[model samples]
Target: MLIGTVGNEPYQRVSSDNGPYEGAMLGAAIGAGGAGAGIFGARMHYKGIDNRAKRHISAIESREPVIQRKINKVNEQAENPRMSFIQKAKSKIADSGINQINNLRTAQLDSLNSKNEQLRNVVDSMQHTNPNVANEADLSRRSHYAQSYADINSHYDDVIQGSRFSKMKQQVDQSMEHKQARIEKNRDVKVSRLNKELEKLSDGRHKWGEDGVKLMKQKHPYAHVKGIGRSAAAIGAGALIGGGAGMILGGLTDEVNKHVKQ
Candidate 1:
């Protein structure tokens, strides 16, 4: 029977029960198995296992608020950038992809603005001075600094707002990078489930392969599914003839033992 699926695809598993209860029991069993696998022989092993996984999951859920707070801080930092003359820069890059990167760019713009303003102030001072040589070398250097700053800022703007698709392409690439690990993990889970199913099918085939020797060995193994199969056969036989207390006793004993074991 098909067990179920996880992730994006539907996967099937082999089992005797095809009913909904099978799934319910399987869920409990997996929970129990995960728990009991750790301690090995603990009582109510399955129950403990089921509970253990739940507890672990609960613990993780409890950390969600703490994680959200940290993410909020990062978001705020990205949203706000501080710099002298950066007010205009921030306004210019308002709708850019990432707030943090935009803030850094705004800061650079602020730096350029400050340099140009300082250069202009210097030039004004020189014109006011008596002798024109207030410092010709310093004035030339300041002029070069302002020109270069303007050029850099213009080039950066060109790269950022050049094309509509550029921002979308960057967003897609970043999304893929973030989801890559989860995709791989989901793939692994699918493959592992398939492998387990294949192994079980192979074991069943080998156990019942023809020539009848392996089949005989399994049928009469040291411990076998003694009650149900035997009783089923006997009942089928008895309905034809009319009576069989021995078959019923064997079946009842088998059922009692199975219940006690469970």
Candidate 2:
């Protein structure tokens, strides 16, 4: 009984003494483990952040030259005049065609006026002759003059109202309309291209800006991660490891106490 008591007393003392020591050791181990895990997680998070930054930087750099070129092109077009050489030539041609029509009309009118003048002179010369003969000559001359004038006027009107002239005018007007349309189309195309280039520049920057946080959330790992820092994951992993270690230590401590009591 004395031997049994001695052994039991030492066992109790050992259990008691070991309890706090084991607790402290387990706590320290858990803390160390957690700290290590947290640091590792923080490093991983930092790596991811750096990688994302590089991706954005690379994309921005790659597109900068293209954007500059587009900007230069747009500026060049803006600095230049609206009318092209072809457009000027078309305008000149149209003016020349109009002038030609006018000249043609003037020439026909002049020819008719000269004929009328000659008839008038003949009628005036006949007035000095015998009265009866002068009267007859004057009447005939006047009739012929009137008839010639009427014929010339009729011919001029017919020529003016001809389908050929109408067709030519129509063709010129249609050509002008087509040319105008082409010029407008070209202008619109240039404007549209410029707008697209501007849009690309704006959108690319937007993807790399603070607004890109929302876009990042849509990605894989970024979506799973709640915070932006590398330390968050590390801290979470450390907490889990520490908690498990603490639980294991508590269980071992409980078993030791039970054994001592028994």
Candidate 3:
């Protein structure tokens, strides 16, 4: 029969066949076994949580240097000039060439207009039997000349719009912008991830409290003392209960045997 409780909870039982001393010993053994199982389970639970926290911390430490190096490299690239002096000079030369070509096209158009005017004057001074033919020929020449003038001007406008230096400047600016954006994105992402990991591991709790092993000890204090204390208390209680129940049972059994004999 179960004889006693630890903390108001029954934990030990004794067999009916056992003598008083034997019953007491069996009850005590059962109590101790139960306490031991409880202690083991508690220890494992605490250890699992602590180990998970430690693994997370270790992972963060190992990855920090690699992440920092990548951050530095990106920062350096963002800060440095994209174009060298040679490249700048080349862009300038290309821009100058474009300007020269635009000027040449303007001069050629002016020359064509002047030559056309002179030919028109010569045609007007000559006598023509068909005046309408002459008029139609002059109109056709004027149309062709206007078309040529418009085409040259359009080409010049295109060249000016696509200036090499301007294009290069825009490209360099865009490249720098992209690099800076990348640096910021990388830093934010890594820092946010690390912070979240630390938060989870620390259970949203930490402080700049101690250093080295002391820090670790503070964070995860030993449970040995508490466990030992509980085990000792349990054993002591079991032994006390077992001894009292054993004496009572022994007296009752003797009384029952004597009654049976009579």
What TM-score fits each model? 0.23, 0.30, 0.35
lDDT of 2 at 8: 42
- TM-score, structure 2 vs. true: 0.30
- Candidate 1, which segments miss by more than 4 Å at Cα? 1-164, 211-262
Give the Cα error of residue 146 in candidate 2, in Å. Answer: 18
Tens-digit per-residue lDDT, 1-262, candidate 1: 0111211111112112133333334444444444334333323343344355455445545554555565455445434423324433444444454454556668887887787678767766776664366567467767787687777767666666564434654554455555555555654565566556555544544443443334454444222323456544433443322223223323344444456579
- Candidate 3: regions farther than 4 A off: 1-24, 34-64, 77-165, 168-172, 175-179, 194-234, 238-262
TM-score winner among the candidates? Answer: 3
| Residue 88 C-alpha lDDT in model 1 | 37
Spell out the clash pairs found in candidate 3.
Answer: none
Candidate 3's displacement at residue 137, Å, is 55
Q: Write the per-residue lDDT of candidate 3 for residues 40-112, one digit (tens) a residue.
A: 6766665566565566556656665666676566656656635556666666675677668778887989898
- The lDDT values for all models are 0.47, 0.59, 0.60
Ranking by TM-score: 3, 2, 1
Candidate 1 local accuracy as lDDT?
0.47
